[model samples]
Target: MRFARAIALGAVTAVTGGLLAAVPAAAQATGAPAASAAATVSVTLTGKAVRADGRAVDEVGVFVVPAARWVDEDAAPVSTALVADNGRYSVTASVAAGSSLYVRVDDWTSSDGYMDRLFVGKGGKAAFTYVGLAPIAAKAGTIELGTATAPKLSTVRVTTSAPVHCAKLLRKNGTLAAMECDYTVDKKVFTFTGMYPGEYTVGAMWSSWTDARATVDVSAKKGVTTAAMLTLESPTTMTGVVQDTQGKALEGIAVWANGPDSPRTVTDATGRYAFKGLTAGSYVVDYSGASGMSSAYRDYVTRTSTVSVTSGRVTTAGSTLTKGAQVTGSVTPLAKETYGTIVALAADGHVLASDSYWSSDGKKRDFALHGLPTGTHTVVVQDAASGRYAKSTVVVSGTSARTVGALKPAAAPVTVRGTVEGTTAGFVSLRYGTSPLYRGAIDGGDVKPDGSYAITHVVPGIYALRSHRTTSTAGYEGNLLSVTVGDGVAVRRIPQPTRKVQTLQTLVRTSVTFDGRALPGVVPLPRRTPADLWGNWTNEKGVGQAPWTGRAWDAVVLEDVFFAYHSPYYFVVKSPTSVTKPGDLANVTVARVAGGPTV
Candidate 1:
């Protein structure tokens, strides 16, 4: 997810009723003239960062950068800070005369993270970058340094109904302040300070625990106490076996189960399989061979069974495999052909057997395939020797043998023939919507020197096509195309889009690095501003917007906010970085208030 800076540029006007009566002489030394000398101007920046459930984010990182360098190389951040505990922050900066400002806020928690970028001034309206994260921006608001109130701190108690694994609780600004754990029988508790009155969410993890989650709200007048109960449930197990058509134990044959709330599991080496932690529900057991043999060899054996597990219980089921029929065919190359190919496909387009061999003396070639189920089959023959092919369907009975007579080579289509360009040479499948109807490569199609080619005899329907290129030189490979196939459809040449084009730009709060490599996760900022600086800054005056540095590849805006910043005129620079996992960083670049935009 991308992170962005929120920058608001407005004229700093004097407070009402002579609030700036003691305007210091040094104020002019920083380039801002006195109230009487020039228009007394003030900027206020304020906003909130919370989870999707409206819980206040604590200790998240936030920053503000100039609009010019939000996504560029030059305009790096100039101001940064951590948000307070209440998910609210305020910053007030007195800008010199005739200057513009940009503000940005970013959260780096794994859930509902966001990076927002906005500009404030007479120059232009604010622009947003929705890379992967979503940001909320506050509209124009008045700021009174003299009347603003400091953020109040309070305490919150979090309790779980049952004993949980007890990971660590984190603030929105990506800070690990303390280590908390409890091995008690029933519950665990944690208290936080310097938190403003607001809604906050706590996350906990536990093993063998079920239905354990909760939320709480805190306020200054009445400190909030939240509790979550953990429920314990027993897990059920399923065991089964697989065998071949001759009633012999088929070791290593893959077996799987699919059903409500059950993930797929593979059988063991002894052809025995077991599914653990299965909730009380109905499940379907599916068995197949490692080579993916067709139903003829008992390709798939499925049984639906229900098991009621009370705490701990073992359920057992057995499966058997049956024999299928055999199919034999011949590949005859045309006069000018060089190679003969034959493929036997099932009703569902599963390749049961396929083989390609060099033509001997340019004569007809014979091939045989065993272990096929009794059913209708689609046979594809390609005579690469003469650049010709044909497709036909045949039926085979489990008890009898089936044969396909000599297939006469057909004339290639001249008017409608094209090749798939910009893709590696692999299987280019074409299918017509929600149906089992489709055709592979064109049997008889004209050839062109260029990759451009077309096809004929296309039926009418909503046709969707895609190419699976075995080898791809660029990211544009494996492209998909959707088209409408009405009666006598003629598809002209369509060009594929390249991946080099960028549709959006995103800004991130903190740069992440893993094993000395940059990862893609934002660092959160605090939501509340400091108490000492309260009443001296408006929410809008202290708002920060980070600029888009031409670095990070893709941004993942976390849901929590912990970082904070003041002054909309500052900027932060970011470079494209990637991380393999989370919480793996050794070095990072952070800029605090050094010489610019101080009250």
Candidate 2:
């Protein structure tokens, strides 16, 4: 109970400091004595640290940070000892009667650091009362010692019934932790444990690697005795035949079992290939060459069908390696370049995964490229020889390919022009739309002084125009406009939509109160004036009423009664001698005051 009180006080200090200062004292009063009389408690703490493979971690630091306040005030150690070379650690501490205890184990230097609380006593009925590096307990049951045996270490042996060399192994950490564990080369298996109970991810490394996760839980009664067994059995084999476009066997052509972890296999002279040791999942079969030739082979050969690998089942995936058209072209500026290197770029602007070649010609200017996929590609003729060059897009089809004309130097100047509206003075932004987009500033033209602007020397192609407002102006308007231009095309401006404004009106009212004692001549109530009162008002009797209705007793009396009743009526006074007539009130003009339904 004293320990509990101390913990409560510590929690309070951790939160709203000093808010619960009185709670600890009150708690101690209700619980057992703060210190027991003439009793000494002995406690022992111990644990082990090891690699995932269960090998004891040697010379590791394992200590505890005390959580309780020392009753003696001066009985606290600054530090504790390191564990033995065999990964075992122990600490003993004595406590006075009624003292509380808590223990923590951790390492600060290792990549895999850990911190945990150690429970003492059978039911974990002890509490932390004093601050110290060694474990402490109030009773003899406060600390219990145990050993952490390293789990058995083993490698996973994967073998496909068929020939496959590209299988992968993935661990619970979500990484292709191991490449193809070819049973033929690395027959050793891998095993890991000493992990707390939980779900873990286990899968193959390649695209075909099946995602198989396992769960482990260790019970308290089991202590450090827990084990898990995982057996990764190979799925069915997929057999296939690969041939060239001419129907000849394509020997050494690599075939891949694709999915999550795509594995690869090589075809035999008989044009036959097999992917073994696969799981039950969708897989793609690809035909290519070994590492270096993969890019070119990928360009020429493609997958034919997806095969399903099931347990003890066989799937067939026959495919052909087409002989794609081979293209050959020569670079003209190889000799005059400094690095004397030429690079070929694909239509998508990606550098071909091929090596750069130097022109063998004496001119040091002529370079040739062969075995290119039949398509349109940009032939970049850099001055590898002269260190200066130009690029031109060329189309390649048949086995023979060549440039039709000499490469010309790139034009340095291009024109940019556009129409602007609503803007008086601000810069327009010009940028290229495609890859390697060029960004530059353009000055506003004199067209509308505040409107359309134009800039010169903009490279030909589609360009984006953005308007920027000056600091003094409000802000830019409209979205970016795209403009296209041909070589030597005139500057042109696309029209921008004009901005418009809308107006609205609503009738608002005001209230006015008048006391008969404050103004004798004024009406004591509200009324509605004739719609044409500003111009003129005529009575049915043909009498012309004054526009102001000034200080008129009849007018006031009539208006007050009309507003009070909210209806047309003949004026009548409470006096019994008073007489009211229609014509008498007709000459009295009334006007509507501000508030709704004045009465």
Candidate 3:
């Protein structure tokens, strides 16, 4: 008990800078008596946040962190809640009974900024000292911590001597904390509001060149504004002209400077193109134009040249265009599948040209690529729904148009099945490893309460199985398991054996509704907020049920966006209206919060 007391005190003091004044020293030290793991409890921390001047915060972000991870730089909130305009918040998170935890409160409202922008500290990292209390035991019911004081938010404004096309604010640790590009065109200034008082670096740029940088400290007082000025250095410029091999100026040719800012312009009447306000650097200038030979077809000329630009001086890079080749092809998609992008890739893996196809379009499934340099290219076509793709190699010689005939059909996609042992609180995904065919990880569905998972529409190949914790914002930790799928395997269960995941026998039948209308495609995120997703966002009707876990509250359901930005409507299940025991119906209704973000 004394060891527990010491660890609790050290952890809390390290986070809060002091002890909670409301709780007695003996109570803080003793905490709640240790309970067996089977006796894990759902604890609710209720509290209010006040500003330095003792005024109640309009809305505050309340978070609970386990003491074990309080010092971990990437620690995530075990549970999160938002205080109402009334300054009161109640958030629930499941923890082992007798576990010591920390409660944090900050001046982060959804209206002003994002959760990551809460408060900036030492290295431009989110500071956690605004309002914190810790070492509280995980009791079965609500625990009230008295009002905690937090600092007032601050604002900073930056002005530049010259017009800055872009600017960024850096944290003390040189991290690109923010680029609150709220630029005032007339004043050549940038405004950053609702920032935690601290030292920050401001860097301004014209085009892609760094003009100047300045450091300033934001005042800690409420409504006090910090201001800083940045002076510019001499500017750089890059100019170019384009003409055909016949010495004829190619007016209206597209000219591009591929460098820092990638400025682009079209050749004027004199075939001249200029890019001012550039950074001092080397640039590759590209010129492209088409010569009218006949109404049936036009020969396209494309050329490139490299030039170096110096500060306060104009550098010229000109190019004489030569006819380039074109690549044309047709694609045939699999039955019931739509065509995705058809890309012509060079041997170096750079995409030369790309176009899309649709099954619904009346035109033939034909694609064409113009202005391609004479080279060998791999023409690839992928199915939109399925990641299956086909590729064909073609060669273009001396401005001659090369044709790739109808591409062969891609191999059929396969399904993968696996079991995630130990915990039912996370999802399993199949990530492509060194597979040029697939682009990203295929959603393997959420690990069911029984720990079994099946992922469909996966391209047959070697893949890495990634386990993502449902309660943490930190995405896919590492490849926990590897899976190799072969063609013609309809449904192959991974060699990994299925293991039982412990669960609280309590089954809660729940139905979610928004504004009295039953909402479909809502995910049941047990004990966590909408910010932490379980990733099993398949279509489940409003009336769904799940077994409660030992390490979770009743449930928190959010509208499933299914790989897209989510809707703002969500609800927390405190208790059922009628039956409260195992295998009972838990009917819940969620109303949209007034003035909250809408879908």
Give each model's whole-structure lDDT: 0.38, 0.37, 0.51
TM-score of 1: 0.32
Top TM-score prediction, candidate number:
3
Model 3 C-alpha lDDT per residue in residues 1-599, reported as the tens digit of each score: 00010000112221212221222344333544443433767887777655555545544322333322222212355777766766676778887776655564444342332222222111112223311233555668987765655544556677877666666665432333446443222236787665544445677655443334334433322346778777766557676667767877767777766655567667766677666677678777656563222212224545657778987887877778766688888878675446677766665444455677877643348888776778777776767677677768888876888888786457666677766656565666675553222234545666678767777766545566655544322222333455666665434333322333222233356665432335344445444322222333222245655444334444444433311111111233333423334333355554322101100
Of candidate 1, the 10-residue stretch with the lowest lDDT total is 590-599
Count: clashes, candidate 3? 0
Q: 1-599, model 1: which lDDT tens digit per residue?
A: 22222222222211224111112224211332322344424555555444334445442222232211222211333444455666565655454332234433344442222212222222211222111111112123442211111122234455554344353333322222222455332235554433323223354544222222432222222123334232333336666776655666665444545544444544444566655556655665545542343323433322224444333566777577655555566766676437756666665454555666566576777766554567887666766644356666778776456777766445341233345565324333454332222223333232244555455544333444554332112223334466554444345454433434222222223443221222222332222221111111112112222223233323222221221221111112122233232221122332210111111
Candidate 3 residue pairs that clash? none
- Better structure of 2 and 3 per lDDT: 3
- Candidate 1 lDDT: 0.38
On lDDT, who's better, 1 or 3? 3
Tens digit of lDDT per residue, candidate 2, span 366-402? 4444444567766544433232445566676644455
lDDT, residue 444, candidate 1: 29
Better of 1 and 2 by lDDT: 1
Best by lDDT: 3
What order do you get sorting by lDDT, best first? 3, 1, 2
- Model 2 segments more than 4 A misplaced: 1-57, 60-62, 66-242, 246-319, 322-368, 373-599
